[model samples]
Target: MFEPVIAPSGTLLGLLQRGRGDGTLHALAAPRAAALTALNQCVLHDPRHDWQVENRSLYYARLFLDLGGGLEDIEAHLFGPGDDPDADETRTGLALSVLGHLASYGRDDALALLRGYAATGANWAWALDELALRDDDAGLRSLAGAVLGRFPATREGDAALAAAVRDAFEPRPWRLWAEDRRVSVGGRVRAARESGSFDRWQRQMRPTGPRPDWSVQSVFDWAQRGADGGSALHVPAARCLGAVAGPDDRPLIVETARSGPDGARCAALHYLAEAGDPAVLDLVETAVADSSRTVADAAVAAFERMCGEAAVDRARGWVHRPDALGASAAGVLACRGGGQDEELVLGALRETVRADGPDAPLLWALADGAGRLGIGCAAPVLRHIYRETSSSQLRGRTARALAATDPSFATGFAVECLWDCEETTREVAALHAETRDARVAERLRRLAADPAEEAEVQTAVRSRIVPQSPPF
Candidate 1:
């Protein structure tokens, strides 16, 4: 999927897209028409950069409930002339998930829409999964005929049916159909169940990679062949080497790490670094300086895996090199360096953001290091990253860092964080947000009572409400 174009963080649509808590606060305060428009736009055009991992369903569902929104837009989108029933899950997964959350919250219309889609929509499996969680047995059983009818009685059709049963995210409906008194429906479902089980067993029993007794040279050849086929099997090949190679093989592995085929060099670097061989560091330095981007990446990654005192000592010398290795060295220190290394970590944090902007992957480790070492001065940078970056996961890490280092966290971002799209972020706010604020108290109570809130967030809310011991 292409990267979504995110609106500026200040706009209502942007806030909603980012799943920031402030989006809810703003949407509620804005004109209902404008808020609903922005909300509908997000639902229609899934804004998450990584849909499978980032969450926006429950967040959008709550807004729809608050706004008394209708399902006309969602219905039109799902069944519209332009809609493709066979489109990938990314297209309709979010909308279906929002519908599921709505159904769970007792929205009968949402449940009805889900039932309609599950019976006929292209993304029926997703809708079916939603219904399985919220719909009654009767509601689900009623659809088995419509669902099963999609497959014919022919051999090809039966195989398709088997694949569907095997890959289903929820088996409640299929299991229900498997017990139907109607032989046509029950027998087909039963057969599909058996077929799916056999397929799973066959997959488990299949052997695809190297086995015991392969020579070290053969292992290197295997790694190279995998690389040639566009598969990076070097890491596993290195593990195979551990089983296959003895002391006599060290020279060969060392030679491979120094100057060998791209695949073998990558595997040897990974293996020697993992084994903590003393001579491997210089080889890694040489590989990092190589012209091949792939080799350089492997070298840096291999360097990051080193965890000895010697690695830390080497990192101190390489920390100021102003190259990829230097940046990685800083991340190494951030993850494993001591409190005395706070200045170095802070410098790396600043330099990285200044050079590569907030979205740079390097900032993830440096940001965590800032919080880990309690560098209070790092709070401003962390807050900047929190506000500007589009990545919710990275934003969550920044919030955690802010909690540890920012003096104003309780009254500031913590309050907004209560409504943040990510559950872990909300949990963080629940734990540290100052209940002294009227909004915080109200949000805490609402979360405590809301069935939709994650259990972890509710646990944190309960702890804040009923402390270990009441006022002494």
Candidate 2:
């Protein structure tokens, strides 16, 4: 029976009484505060229903997402989206109390809400910890866990819960017998796969038959993650990258190369180079067409790396030499260089050396490669950027390039660069001090003595002036 005299206004916790297995105990329709009071009074009458509790547990979990709500909100006002008067928190207890239900009940609504909380980008321990506690459903857990795992800064939140979740779901040696949906158990499965503990792989994961397609899907998916990918979903995904792309596996090597990230692309390229196959050349050759700069860079780098010196010349030819795109392509080829292509490298370097040169737009693609690949051949261009570049950053960069290839100091170029009044030019000159070539030391001595020099230039040269060994 309803108690009208005792019932209050506002919020949905007032008219409630005892609920039970019949799913009809939650009749209150007032504010959460009043609902808790009435529910408390009715608690002495009967217990809450499991099904009703399940739904209410989810609704209370939703309230936790309030911009400024907490446990007190759920304690009094919590109710689910069902018609049952059986909505009760008396057993599930409080806000933190419902986490077990959300993860354990296979509740999509609860999981969805948890993801919404993560969308805030600020630290949300309650949401992450709830997920960390997840024990099954690899697809569901990965969708949430991978995102959270990327932000290690939040690991401190709900430490116990997070650890329990991490430990429970770590990568394992997978031998999924798709006869029935089931998850095998072992605390060390992930460890064995990660550490390349071959003994364990042989001991625990020899395939009983050809693995199901579902199992290899994660491995292929991970390949798409590019460099920052890893998984325990299937047998191939479980194998180490180096082994999977070995010489015999040209298709696998090329497939991984097309995926994301510089490092993975490089790895795949290196493997394919050794695999000695031309099958992936089209993918690598066309990589320049990719919209992502990083992917394009990787693709070019892979072509150069896998295809070697000949690939560099081909990529250079493909580089449209009119604008930044041409200069960039030339630069990549320039770095890995074949001296026979000296004429082309010089032509591009000459274009980059103009007073109106586009050096500042991309020094990485320009002078750096010239200094590395064309040091003997590209020295004049390097010296030109070192001397004529208006940007201090480019000047400093050129100096590093000259040093990288162990420059031929006999060219007297280091002296000219260091003597330039620009502090950046002088900084480039100072690096030649390591040339330990006496002429370089002489140039530095002259620099350190020039009191009229800009303070940065003076400091740079003095630092490189060979200390007590300076004749100046």
Candidate 3:
């Protein structure tokens, strides 16, 4: 995936790109033309740090509804000149998802667009899946010819059709087509279904990876093979070691962790750390000092996995150091340290933001730790991260941390958070956002009635609303 170009956090585009709640508030307050332009930019070129994980479709769709926006930009983006539907789904998946949400909200234009795309789009499977969730049987039945026509009657075509049936995310449309007498697809669909089931069975029957009888050396060899192939297998190989190694194998395991080949050393370190070997801490410290980044990263990861008091004690001693191990020790304290370690966690939170800015990967764990520890003083830092970070997932976590520590959350971020991209963030808003504001109450009512909202978010909304108000 290409690295997304995130605008400055102060701009409306940046706020929207980050999926911050304030983006919706600002967009609504801005001139309609500018807002629509920014909104179109976001929907047309997804700004999510990881589109597969971060949520923006529903948020953008809701904005469209509020703005009374048209689907012209979306249509142009989906079916524009030079656009390749057969290309990576990432290119068009976000737009399709936005359209799907819009359809759920009873947008006839959105539904029509989806029906058109599924029949001819290269990413027809994705569009079909969207229709499966929202379209009627008639709407789905109309697409069988176009969808099935993708495969010819040749043997290779049949094989491709079977694979499509087997890998489909939604079988509703396919099943309906297979059962409908009016549609001529019944015979072919039934054959494809049977072939797909057989393909699944054949794949499951094929055995791969380490068996229960694997020896420690065998596990090491497997890890080495994965390393040579550029895949990391040390974590699983370490688990395999746990199953196979005996009391007599301690010395060899220790030696492997100390001076073996890279793959074996990493695996041995993970195994020893998980086993809580008394000498594992020193070995981890030594491995951290190693020159190879892979070995050092593995060593730090192994150290962080440790949950014993011994690990905590070592963390306190190492937390002040400036190396990666020190950063990891701070994280350990943030995750597993006691009340006394609160200051260290806060300091680490600040230092990380100051040193690497809010988008640092380490902030995710540290942000959770801040909330878990109830560090009230960390509120300012948490708020900064919530606003400036381009990652929606991280912003959601930071919002949680803020709710736990910031007293103004109920009146501040919580109100805007009701419109945040991530459902979990919105859920937090529903639970804590003060209902004193008319906007909060209206949003609560709307969310409670919206069929597209998550069940958890709806439940949270209902909890905040009066029970006597039937059907929201």
Candidate 4:
């Protein structure tokens, strides 16, 4: 997949791409044509940095409803010349999902579009999953012939069918077809279902990897062999060392950490760090400077896993080092440090944003630390990350942090957060947003009534709104 180019945070298109609630508010107030153009672009292009995890379909679908948009753009994109439905799900998954939400909201055009795409689209399975949730029995039953026809009666086709049945995100459509009396789909589907189940069981029964009783040296050798084969097994191998290594093995383990082969040294560092061996910290410092980046990374990871006071004390001393170890030390303090470390955590948060920009991975832990430590002055930088970071998950974390540190949160970001793509952000809004705003109360009612809203969000909404009186 190609990397998405996000617009500047100030632009309407950029806000929409970020799935910010403000995008929806802005789109509703802007010229309908301009808003629809930007909205359509986002849906068709799939702007999420990580499509599999970040949410956008619901956010977009609601905007479409408010804008009174048609499905013409979506249909054109799905079936346009040069577009391959089966090429990659990411290309069409967001559009299909938006149509699914529209169908649930009682849009006949959306439902019909989904049905048409499921019959002939390359990403038919995604459409079929959407139909499974909203379509009635007859609607799904009608799809049996078009869908099943894709798999021929040949051996390879049957195998393909079995795999589809095995991995389907929704089984309702398949189950309905299995019970259909009008076609041969029943027997074939039943066989596929059985085959899929047996295949799953067989996979479970297959054994791989080293057994639990292997000696420490044997485990190290296995890890080295795996490294040679292009798979890193040192992590699990380090666990094996925990089971096999006794006091007598300590000297050997320490020596391995000091000068053994790359794989063994990595494993020994992890094991020794977990054991909190007195000599491990010095060894970790050396490994961080090792010629091998792999060993250096392993050493940093091993040190981060240490939870003892010794590790925290070491983290304070190493936090200023201008290397990967220093970065890891900042993360450790962010997660486990006390009030004394607040300034250091804030400094790291500032430096990471300045050095790597708002989307830097290190900002995740530092953002959390800013909130946890109640660093009030970090609010501006947190706000910067919240607005410019393309990651929805990271943005949500920033929202939580802002709630703790920003005094203006309840009336500012909180109001717009009610429309955020992430439920966690909406829950935060529900708990803290100023209900005096007309939009906040209206959204809270809709969320309270919408069956699809998450349980946590609804619970938060209930806390703010009085219970409705039953009909007299």
Candidate 5:
């Protein structure tokens, strides 16, 4: 592996071995503020980069934490308010692996420190995710709500923390619809109908200024004040029991949904449902009472998105409305509220999942459904897109839907995509296949002999198909 750029200092290691965490931490060997600054190094993508193969991504993560600068702080500096997203994405990917570990087994303060970063870190891509995975729902929602009310006072939501929220909120609309459908009993049919996008869901987005990564960001605020049952149904029950803050609370979602924008109410309902708290039923009913048809439709969508096996009978009440059947089917699929309502979801979709249809948004919903339902039955239709679809974009998306549902097929197609180097197919093909696969060698070697290969193709071929591991 290439030598570590920020290797743990020798004396530093010796000191830690002698048992020094708090002392060294407070001493500011790497200032918490300094560590919070971003780190993105530029390398020639040459033999030096090969170092990662030897130790895997070990170059960027653990030792960095051991050095005590803290990954969260580093993420903030790199992606925070004044940072560059594309320029810093590579470094953040390395940092992300580091942050994941910190969340799971780092010091109590280490987790808190990361949480603080999640709160305040620049929107460098993974900031929000790190927040979510670490269970900071309030922070996540706060960030979401704030962003919607007003973008950070910068061009393109420049604040790193804000950017992070936007990244998650940005809809791969088709992907979402398709995923929704993929995981549903209705499969592609639902996607072929009324699924929506970030535009539709935007009414629900609100983002605030970033907070300390160490701050608890609100993942499960429901089981609080010393409540601890650990039941399988705890989160669901908490939500149903009205875990959502009422109108008196800051940014009252129910009120926002009722009187806010077009789909605001749906987003509110959706967020509540995902809270994994069944206690939210009163809130849902209250929302329905206060809602416009648009909002009511959205609230129903929330039920599909969040409520699962725990709230079956109540969820069934939603499917009875054929006009709102799409959202209801999605709700049931999301949490399996009424067991596997595959027929119900599919019944909703049968009218929509047509080829060459205008329902692109719904296609993403379909994909999401298929993924949730875990149905291998839809593979044929997906495989059909792979073989016969004329629109490359749709074809690729369909393939994505398939892969999301069955990762094995995604991996398989990715290898073949590498060889599809015709002008029309090159980037899409390259996108699916990574450069480091074992078979890449043979593929590149084959390309190396092609006199008709484009210059770009030949460069790619020769750069990778090493007869031997080209020494640094």
Candidate 6:
């Protein structure tokens, strides 16, 4: 997938594309033509950084409903000339999702569109999955022939059908087909189901990696071999070590942590760190300074996993170092440190943003630390990161930080955050956004009523609007 061109933080389209709550407020206030145009752009293009996790379908669907928008743009986009339905699902997943939400909102046209697409669209499975949640039995049943016909009466086709049945995100439609009265439909589906079951069982029975009875040396060797093959099997190999390694095997483990092959070294560090070996911190610090970037990264990650008091003490001492270990140390402290370590965390946050800019990977931990520590002075920095950072996940973390630190959050970013592309951010907005703003109350009501809204978000909305009974 290509990186989407995000609009400047100032524009209404940018705000809507960013999934900001203020975007919704602004769009509602703007001319309906302008609002629908912007909403259509988002629905057709999909502005989310991570479509699978971030939410825009419900937000856009609600906007379409409010605008009384027709489905022509979406329909044309889905069935447009040269559009490959069988290509990557990213192209049409957002549009299909939006239609799903619209259908849930009682849009018969949207329902019809989904039914039509499921019968012939390239990404028919995704459309079928969406319909499985909302479409009636008759609507689903009618499409069985078209869907089943996609697979031919051959071994390869039957195998593909079994894979599809096995991997389906929603099984209601397949289950329904399995019970169909038609021999062609029900029989084929049943055979596919059986094949899928056997496939799963065969997979379970297949031997993979070292077994529990494998020697520690053998496990490390397996890890080394996997590493040689360009696979990072050390993570699971470390788990195998836990099962296989005994008291006398500490020497071998430590040897690997000190200077083993890249894969074995990585696995050993992970094992020792998770085992909470007292000497693991120093070993990690040493590994972080190693010449190999892979070893250094593994070391840093292993160190961060160390949540003991000793690890915090080590972080305090190493926070001043200007290297990957220093950054990881600060992150460890930020995540696991207490109020006493606030200054260290703050120093790291400012320095990281200064050196690496808002998009720095380290800022995620530092931002969360700022929030957990209630560093009121860090709100400005958090807000800057929130606006300038292209990462929605990072922006969500920044929103959480601002909520804890920014006193004006209830009316400021919190309101805009209600429409944030990330559900967690919207949940934050629902929990904290002041209802005094006219839009907040209405948004909450719409959220409460929208069948497509996330349950957590709606639950948060209900908590705000539904009055609590007085204590006895």
Local accuracy of candidate 6 as per-residue lDDT tens digits, 1-110: 66788888788788888777677778989999988898888888888777866778887887788789999998898887746854678889999998998999899999
The alpha-carbon lDDT assigned to residue 125 of candidate 4 equals 96
Residue 295, model 3: lDDT of 91
Q: Please, what are the lDDT tens digits per residue for candidate 1 over residues 384-432? A: 8988888888888899999999999999999999998899999999999
TM-score of 3: 0.95
Off by over 4 Å in 1: 209-213, 467-472
Name the lDDT value of residue 207 in candidate 2: 59
1-472: candidate 3 lDDT, tens digit per residue? 5678999989999988888888999999999999999998999888987887899999999999999999998898888763685466877889999999999999999999999999988788999999999999999999999999999988999999999998999999999889967534888888899999998898789856544337878888888877778888899889989989999999999999999888889999999999999999999999988988889999999998999999999999998889999999988988898889999999999999999998998899899999999999999999999888999999999999999999999999999999999999999999999999999999999999898899999999999998675685
Clashing pairs in 6: 19-419, 21-416, 22-416, 85-122
- Residues 120-139, candidate 4: write the lDDT tens digits: 88889999999999999999
Model 5 residue 400 CA deviation in Å: 4.9
Best by lDDT: 4
lDDT of 2 by residue, 1-472 (tens): 2221322222123212111111111322235554444443433222223232222333332222311122333323323332133443232232333543444545455555445443332223344445545534453334444343433433343343334334433332122211123222222223323434454366577756333233223334554453444322222333434444344555555666676354445455444544445655666555556665665664554454443555565556766546434555577566766666556666666665663453455554556666655456666667556544434355556666666554564345455454332355456667554546665676567556754345776677666554457586
Q: Which is the winner by lDDT between candidate 4 and candidate 6? A: 4
Local distance difference test, each candidate: 0.90, 0.45, 0.91, 0.92, 0.42, 0.88
**C-alpha lDDT of residue 393 in model 3:** 96
Clash-forming residue pairs, model 3: none
Error of 5 at 62 (Å): 37
Whichever of 1 and 4 has more lDDT, that candidate is 4
Name the runs in model 2 displaced over 4 angstroms: 1-217, 223-240, 246-249, 252-276, 290-297, 304-307, 319-329, 353-358, 361-384, 387-393, 397-472
Candidate 5 lDDT score at position 43? 17
